[model samples]
Every structure is written in C-alpha cells, then in structure tokens.
Target chain A: MTAVSIDSAPKTAARRRERLASGRTYISAALIFIWCLIPFYWMIVTAFRDVGYTFDSTPFFTHVTWDNFNTVFSESLGNHFGRNLLNSLFVAGVTTVVALLFGVFAAYALSRLEFRFKFLVLGFVLGASMFPGVALVTPLFQLFTNIGWYGTYQALIIPNISFVLPLTVYTLTSFFREMPWELEESARIDGCTQGQAFRKVIMPLAAPAVFTTAILAFIASWNEFLIASQLSNDQTKTVTVAIAYFAGAQAHQEPYTAVMAAGTVVTIPLVILVLIFQRKIVAGLTAGAVK
Target chain B: MSTLAQPKRAPETPSPKTKKVQKEVGQDRAATSQGRWAFWLISPALVLLAVVIVYPVVNAIIMAFQKDQGLDPVTKVFVQGGPAGFDNFVHWLAQQCGSAACAPGTLGAQFWSAVGTTFFFTVVTVVLETVLGFWMAVIMARTFRGRSALRAAVLVPWAIPTAVTAKLWFFIFAFDGIANKLFGTAILWTGSEWPARWAIIISDVWKTTPFMALLILAGLQIIPAEVYEAAKVDGASAWQRFTQITLPLVKPALMVAVLFRVLDALRMYDLPAIMTQGSNGTTTLSILVVDQIRQGFNSAAALSTITFLIIFLVAFIFVRFLGANAVASATPKTTKGQEK
Candidate 1:
C-alpha cells in the first residue's frame, strides 16, 4: 500500500505538470493570435466605421457604416481607389505571366539539363534577387525617362518581372529537381521527342508547382512599391501608391476612415487567398530556406 | 551441343554490353543537345535581367561619379555638369559642400545619422523577431490541436502588403487610437522620437515574426521525433532538450531567417516613409537615398551605391563567416546521375 501510494503520487504530479504545460501553450497561442491580429481587426473595424466617428474610443464595433468604403471609391474626393486597383492587377498580372513564362523554361534547364555554368546562372539569379530596389530606382528612372517609357505599364511590369523571376526560377527549379525523370525517360522511349516529353509528361506534373510559384510571384508584384512609387505617374499609380497618397475630403483632415477602407479593400482578397493556399505558400517560402 | 551453346551465350552477353555502351553514347549526345537547349532557355531571362538589373546598376555607379545637372552656386545657372571625381562620395561621406562641413538639415548632413538609424532598426528588429519567432515556432511545432488554425492566423500579418501594414499601424498609432486607450496614457506614438522608433519596431516585428517562425518551424519539423524521445530516456529536462538538441538543429534556419530580416530591415523605407515621413530622426538609408534623389540625382546615386555596398558587405559576411548555408540550402542536393 505504501509503494502504490508513492508511485501514484508522482504519476499524478506528472499528469498535473503535463496539463499545466498544455494550458500554458494554449495561453501563449491565444496571446500570439491577438498580437498578430489586433492591428488587422482595428483596420477592419475602422474601415466599417462611419467617417465622423474615426476616433470613437470604444474598442469593439460601434457606429458601423459603409460610408468610408464609399468615400474610398468616390473620385471627387481625389481618391483613385478603383483605378489604382485596376492598375495593380494589370501590372502584377503581366509581371507574373512573363516571369513564369521565362522562369519555367529556365528552371527546367537548370534542374533537368546537364549544362556548364549552371551554378553560375543560379548564383546570378540569387544575386539579382538580393539587389536593392533603391539602387535601381535612380538608373531605371533615368533610363525610362530617356526611352520615353516612364509611367508606362511596361516600365512597371519589366522591373517587377526581373524581381519576381528569381523567386519563380528558384522555387520551380527545386520542385523540378524533385520530380521523377523516369516518366520522361519512358515517354522518350515511347518515341516522344524531348520537347514532347517535357510538354506531355513533365509539364502536366509541374502544374502544381507552377501554380504555387504564380501565386507568390503575383503577390510580390502586387505588393511592389519602391520602384513603382518613383516610376508611376498619377494615371498608372498602383493601389499601394494610391493608399499612401490617399487624400481627405477637405484639405486639412486626415481621411483615416477612408484610408482604412482602402487598406481593407486591398488586403482582404490577399488574406483570403493566403488562408486558402496557406500550405502551398508556406511550401514555396520554405523551399528555398531549408533543404 | 554444350560448346555451341557457350559460343552463342558469349556473343549474346557482348551484344548486351555493346548495347549498353551505345545507350551511354547516345545519352552523352542528348546531354550536349540539352545543354544547348538550356542556353537558349535561360538567355531570355538573362537578357531581361541585364536590361533591368545589370545595366541600371552600372548606370548608377557611373551616375555616382558624374555631377548633377543643376545650378552651380556661383554661376547661379543650370549646368549639365561634367565628371566630378569623388565629389559625390565626399559630399556624403565627409558631409561637406566644396570644403566645409554641410550645415544642419542639408541632405549630406543626414548621411551618418541615417546610417546609424538603419543599423539601429536592423539590429533591434532582427533580434526581436528572432526571439519572438523562435518562441512562436516552438509553440506551433508542438503536437497540438488547432495547430493549423494557429499557423493560418500567423500568416495573416505576413500576407498583408507592407504599404498596407504601414497604414494599418498608422491608424493604430494615431493620437486618439486604440493604442493610447489600451496603454491608458496618451504617449504620442508616431509624433515623438523614441515612441516613433518603437512604433516602427513593434509594427515591423509583428509583420515579419511570422516569416521567421515559419522558417524555424520548417527546421523544427525536420528534426526527428526520435531525438527528443532518446533525450527524454536519458532524463533530459525540457530546457536541456531545447538548448542541446532543438537550438543547434534550428540554427541554420534561424541564421538564414535572421540574415534575411537584417537585410530587409536595412532597406526599410515604406514603413518610415508613410508612418512618419522620416521625420523626428527615423530616416533609414533607403529613405535618405529617396530624399536625396528629389534634390540631386547624382548625389542620390552615390548614396544608393553606398547603400548597395553596405548590403552586399553584410550578405558577404553572413554567407562567409556565419553558418547560414543560404546558397546550399537554396539549391537542390541531388545534381548527378538523376537526369536522363
């Protein structure tokens, strides 16, 4: 009886400790969730709040209205929210398409083909990825001005492609290298040419990887602001630049509510997309970071 | 009959061997052709890179040496100035105009302070993110219910645009915002000096800690569960297991994450640009470069070149001295005998 009591006492203690550790984990998890999300919650709450109640002290929802979102869309208020969204879509779309188009072929070669200077090419891509946008701003500004290409979609798309291409190539190369080449070999044995084998067997298998790369590249291009801010004219300004320069109804007011609405408008779609593709996005991100 | 069968079998064996050689020769030829295809495949990206990245970098360096096309103070007229040897560099590095030190509020005068501010933000933000992210990663890495939900929640901040992040935090730091209410003191968050810097740090930490956590979580997942079980069997405490096993194993991912965060914090512009407009001593090197560009293009070029050199130097140090293994991790491990 004494032995049983002693053993049971320690076991209960261990169980209690386990329960306490789990409780702590949940508490910290809750804290982290709030810490990450409070800013977003504030943004959304303010976005829906009436313009006059921008400073409403209540932490919870109050004076909810759509007026702020309306103000964001109202052009007479000097807010180009709609036009800016369209511009963002156009630039990011074209950039993604072009980067993927070039990136897929380059990645395939880097992964599947036996080539000289392969690592050199990979190194170049990595280096370009790390090149500072500020460094390129002045020269690209001047060059675009000289070529009469400033404020053009091509101006934004071209530079964005250069930036996003490295990410696309790197991610896709790793994905391709992991693919089974035996299928391609069998296709070749069955009388398919190299290109045919790539198209029929390899590309179909590569679709998921391509999709992941596209999402990342698109998001990156969409969020680009540095060179965009310098190179874009009023007509071609992106949503980010538009939000940065968001104006008030009158000259002196802050336009806080309307800006929040604009921020919400731009962010909600991305947030939803990320939540949906969370796994794939995480895979793409960590693919280059870990072996 | 035995002799005849032996001769026939010997010929059959050599035929199979000869076929294998022929196949190898064919593969070698296909490899060369594929190499040529690779050259063509990559040239388009290489050319675009040259035009967009390479040429511009070269142009920036050249522009850094050339004088700005502006009024000569004595002449008081616009002059497309000719080459100026180290004048642009000296203007920034020495904080001088001609010979004397630049007066306060001049673009040149802010150079060193911007450098300092950049380094300050880099160090503070990277360190905070690494610590917070590691903790977050440890929690997320544990086998718990709602783990996926936690991960998805964490990604929200990372997915939001940097510009939007700046604006979101801007509203939070407003004079009559929730931050003031929560703290119960009306400290001017974005208006004052230290508060403004801290505001940037807090928002930056919030935005990027998820990235660090995610990277570290990937590292943590790769650590075999057997390792912990074995350590447990040896009576290792949680702290001992974490430091001795988890920390060392996660170091590579941690280093890479920190390297990226440091480089990113160094070039921080959008946050400060929108939040405070680089007022009250928050101008980073990128902001300084952008501000200088508005006044003098050549000087901005010089400043940006300097910024480039600094970032490049940091990357070199991280890759060379630190055990980040950035390039090796980025590339695939299997390179030989796998391709047809």
Candidate 2:
C-alpha cells in the first residue's frame, strides 16, 4: 500500500504538469474559435439592430428587431436587392449543375482510364484553373458585347462555368480515384455491362463526392464578383454586386442596417450548407490540395 | 433481363468456333475500345473548355497586338486596326518605367502602382495566412470534444462571399465601427492608404486562412503518429520533433497551398474593389486591368497579357522545379505506365 501510494503521488504530479502545458493549447483553441466566429456574430448583430443604432459607441446588441430585414423586403430598393438575391441563386445554381455535368465525365476518365498524353491533359486542366479571371475579363467583355450577350445572365453564367469547371474536374478526379476498382470489376463480373456497372454501382458511391463538389461549385459561383460586376446590369445583378451597390432609404445615409440584413440573408444559405455538410466540404476542399 | 442473363451464360459456355475468334481479336478490341471510350467520354469537357477558355485566351493574345479602337457603334464588336507591332506593350512598359510613349501620372503610372500593391498584398497575406493557418491547423488536428464544431466555425468565413466579407469588414472598420472602438482610435481605414491596405489584408487573412489551415491539416493528418512517438522515445523535445518531422513532411502540401494562394492573391480584385473601390492606393493588377479597359481596349489587352504571362511563368516554375505530380497527390496513380 505504501509503494502504490508513492507511485500515485508522482503520477499525479506529472499529470498536473502535463495539464499546465495543455492549458495553453486549450486557451489558444478557444481564442481561435472566438476569432473565427466574431465577424459572423457581428454581421448577425448588425443585421438585427435598427439603422439608428448602427453607429453607437457601445458595441452591444440592443433594441434588436427584424426591421432591417423588413426594410430589405419592403422598400423599392429592397425589391432590387431581392431580385439580386434571386439572380445570385440562379447564376450559382446553373453554374454548379453545368460544371458538375461536364466535370463528371472528364474526372472519371482522368481518374480511371489510360489514354495518350493523360498527364498533359491533366496539366492543361490544372493550368486553366489557375488562369486569372481578371485576364479573361477584357476579352470576355469584348466578346459578350459583340455577341449581344452583355448584361445578360448567360454572359455571367458562361464565364463562371468555364472558370469553375477546372476546379470541379480537379476535385472530382481526386474523389473518383479514391473509389475501389474492384467495385466496378465485380459489378462487371456480375452480368453488368461497363456502362451499367458505372451508372448503377460506381455512381451511387460517388454521390457523396458529387454532392460535396456541387456545394463547393455552388459556393464558388455564388461568390464570383469580378465577372458578375462586369457582366450584369440591374436586372441581372448578383447579390454580391448588389451588396456592393446597396444604398439606404436616403442618399446621404449609408444603408448599414439594410445592407447588413441583406448580407445576413446571403450568408445564411452558405452557413446552412457548411453546417450540414462540413465533413464533405472539408474532404472536397482538401482532396486536390493534399494527398 | 433475359437478354443480359443470356449473355452471361453464353460467355460461360463459349462455343469452339467463337473461342478461336475471341482469342485472336478480343483483347485488342477491348483495349482499343477502352481508349476510344475514354476519349469520347472526355471530349465534351475538352470541347467546352476550348470554346470558352482557349478561344478567349487566344483572342486576347491577338487583341494585345492590335490597335485599341473602341467597340463599333453599330455592331458593338471591338473594331481591330492594323497590327501595331508592340506599340501597346511599349506604351505599357513606359507607364511602369516612365518612357517617352507613356508618361508619369497617367494610367500607365497607375498600373505600376497597382503592380506594387499586388506584390505587397501577395507577400504579406501569404506569410500571415501560412503562419496563422499552421497554428489553426495544429489546433484543428487535435482530437477533442467539439473539434468538428471548431472546424465548421473556421470554414464559415471561407464560405461567405468575398464581396459580403468586404462589406462586412468595411462596416466593421467604419469611423464608428467595432475596430475603432476596440482599438480606441478612429482611424479612417477605407479612406486612407496603409490602414485601407491593412483592412484588405485583415479581411483576406480572415477569409482565406481557413483554406490554408484545411490544406495544411490534410498534410498533418497523413503524418503517422508513430513518428512522433518514436521521437518521444528517443528523448526528442516537442520543438525538435516538430522542426524535424512535421515541417519536412508537411512541405509539399504547404508549397502547393502557398502557390495556390500566391496565384490567387496576384489576381485579387473583389476585396479591394468592393471594400475601397481601389481607392487610397489599394489598386491591384486586376483592378488596374479593368480600369484600363475603360480607357483603351488594346492597352488593357497588353496589361492582361502581362498578367497572364506572370501567372504562367510562376506556374511553369512550380511545375518545372517542384515535382510535376505534387498537386496530383490527390489522385492515386492507377494507370498502367504513368506512375512517377
């Protein structure tokens, strides 16, 4: 009993020392968490507060109301803001669907099949992904204007698809490569044709990846600002562009409340997506960047 | 169903006549068809890519050499003039270097400043992001209660639109905003030079640090725990273990992540444009290109060509010096002969 107690006393002392070391780690983690979350919290706080209370010296949430949100929907400018939100949704949605459609086949081929100059092709796609959107802006502006596609949704959507397609291919290819080869082989042996095996067996397995890719593609297209700013007029302006040009009820006052409310509106969908599919999003994000 | 089932039985009970034919051509046919199928499957993407990306890029190259006559009034298409033979390029260089063709205090001068700003932004933000991201990644990689929640919180900023982030930051740095209250100084962030630049940097760091951390975390995850344990057994300190083991192992992923960020940073447009409208000496290469597009098309094309070349060169260097497959680590090399 004396020996065991002696051993226990030393063990307890060591644990205490270890805990002291770990204490810093926890504190830093908490600080990181707070740093990450404060901006978002600020946005939400600003969204609920009245326009009059936006510039108070005190930085606490007080007299919170849905009035700013109401203002975003009620006023004439709010209608425009509302339309911009719709435009953003449509543009982002179409970009996601179209890119994924093109990406799946290419990703599948790159990941699974052997062909001539395969690395070269993959290299080319990778290069294109890094193609500066700004570099393309002038040429696209000229082309779109010439084709009478300027100030149109298709104008914005087309450019977005081209830029984001490479990302989709890279991310999805990595995902497709991770799928077991035998799944397809067994499906083939079990009286399934190559096409049938892919569609029925492989695709179901790839659904989660596809969904992750979709969310990423969607978020990217949603976040597009430079091209959307150039391509769209009032009717087709995206939420990002709209937010940039957002005005108050009066010209002199900056519509901080309405803008915050609108900002919150735009942010909510993305937050929801991240919360629901955080795991998949992380996987999708790290897929190409890390092994 | 019967047709499919019939094929399965036929293959099993292959006739003698067919067996000879199968042996002669079946393997060759399957190989050729597989290649053909692969080509066919990938062609749609290749075609779409060529039409959209390749065509425009080629067009821009050509346009850079042509005279910058504004768009036609009737057709709205850019009207091309006689080949100027490096006139635009020379003019652009003059703006940056103060040549005869282009003078100081002009658009070209502005372009030079933007380039400098871009260089500054890229270096500063990339450094901050890498360091902070590494710290955040270390935190994220730790297994604990609510680790998943922490990761989600970190990604919230990444998911938010850049423009929204810009606006959010703009408000947060306003005269009466939280930044002033927190710092106890009412500096005009957006209306000034260094403060404005800092605002952009702060927002960018907040927005993209998650991406850096996520990429680094992936690298960290691949590092087996046994290496650390082995080092511990050898009486290595935490600092020593980290420097020797973690840093070396994490280099490739870090290289890739930094390369990606550097490229993206060089093309920065949205944050500065939305936050400060490229005012107060915060103009970047992209905003400059867009600005020049308003003044003259050919000049804008020239500037864009320069931007593309810089990006291309950086990519080329990365690929040439770094192992070409560094970024391709995402996919296993499953093909027959393409293995590194």
- Report the C-alpha displacement of residue B142, candidate 1, in angstroms: 1.2
TM-scores for all predictions: 0.93, 0.91
Q: Is the docking of candidate 2 incorrect, acceptable, medium or high quality?
A: medium
lDDT of 1 by residue, A134-184 (tens): 998888887888899999998888888778998898888877877787888
DockQ of each: 0.54, 0.54
Angstrom error of the Cα, residue B13, model 2: value is 18
Which residue pairs of candidate 1 clash?
none
Candidate 1 C-alpha lDDT tens digits along B1-340: 1111112322334577786776566666666777789999999888878888888888999999999888865567887978988999999998987667888987789999999999999999999999999999999988778888899999999989999999888888888887888788888899989999999999899999999999999989999998998898788998999999999988888887888788788889889998999998999999999888778888889999999999999988887898665666655554432321
Candidate No. with top TM-score? 1
For candidate 2, the TM-score of chain A alone relative to the native chain A:
0.94
| Proportion of native contacts kept per candidate | 0.68, 0.69
lDDT tens digits, residue span B1-340, model 2: 1112222333545799996666556555655666787898888888888887888888888989987776643467886676877877876765632234345456777766887899899999999999999999998888776788899999999999999899999999998898999889979999999999999999999999999999999999999998888888788998999999999999888888988898899899999998898998998989989888877777788899988887888777776686434446644455433643
Candidate 2 Cα misplacement greater than 4 A, ranges: A1-10, A57-59, B1-30, B70-80, B96-103, B322-327, B335-340
